[model samples]
Target: MTPKHVQINKQIKLHFALLFVSCILATYLSGPSLSSMPLLQWLLTGLFFAGISVLPLLFFIPTVMAPNARNLSWLGFFLLAYLVWGVVKIFSPNGLIGGLLVCTFILTTFFYTVIWLRPLKKAAKARQQLEQD
Candidate 1:
């Protein structure tokens, strides 16, 4: 890869990390954290909600930390559930803001992930053609 590609990859990874953090924040926002609850209850509720939503994504930590085309593609596919959840939950009476935020974060992550993978995919295809030739 050229220096330009290396630099772009670093930037893409940084943006993707930021998107992931924002998505997690959206999830936490969806829970009862904003309600007028006591300190302990609020803490537990926030933690449980965040934990359940984030636990599955934790499996992709390796992929996020060191991205490759295949793993990044898989991660994109995995995020579809979050996307759908956001869209569906938007209609709920109490979750409007949180749902909108979730939709925003998930869509940003998905599209950015695709952008990040495009160059890597082209490079992989080039290598495959070289091997065949």
Candidate 2:
């Protein structure tokens, strides 16, 4: 892979990690803004909120590092779930900077995935057609 390809691969990983962290932050950071909850309580609340919501991403670590069009497509679909969560969080009570942050990261990640996948897919399609000749 070229340097640019490698850069985007690393970025996809970073984005997922950020999304995971933002899920926790959306809960932990917002609660303090609305209430006088103690640090530990808010922390646990954040952990519980993030538990099942974004954990599936852990399964994609290896695939994302060496992404192919097919695997990236699968991950793209998975990111929709996060987009929904981010949108919901946008208007939900705890929604605040975290909601926006989550949405921002998700979009950036998806954009990069698409940019990476497009050429690979086109090349694959071209190669398949040539093989048929």
Candidate 3:
């Protein structure tokens, strides 16, 4: 494969890794006290629903925004959403534990933002060099 293809693949792999790790960490930190359901069932259901909900935004939003600005704006939106969710959960019947889990999701979002931005910077630099050449 071409270097560009390889780079894109690498970036995609890194993104997936970030998503996976963040999900795991969020689950762990959120607490084990899920509503008496089977663990695999809960995990699969959540993953499926979240993927369905999030994937479209993930795929389309970057194309809508300028490439350099996309990562920052996306991260900001994600962080804000998570914070709002946390606040709502905190005040809801679920209370503090749910709030803490939402906070963990916020932290995970931050980590993903950092990882994503690093590669985005590198990709930008690579593009610049290609333009110069």
Which digits, one per residue and each the tens of the lDDT, describe model 3 over residues 1-133?
4565455445544553444445444443343445767888777766665565345336534432333346555654766665665666566563466466555656654554555467667888999999999
Would you list the C-alpha lDDT of every candidate in the order shown? 0.72, 0.80, 0.54
lDDT of 2 by residue, 53-112 (tens): 667877777777778877889889988877898888888786868799889888988988
Instruction: Judging by lDDT against the true structure, name the best candidate.
Output: 2
Could you tell me the TM-score of candidate 3?
Answer: 0.37
TM-score per candidate? 0.73, 0.82, 0.37
Query: What TM-score does model 2 achieve against the real structure?
Result: 0.82
Task: For candidate 1, list the clashing residue pairs, or say none.
Answer: none
How many backbone clashes does every candidate have?
A: 0, 0, 0
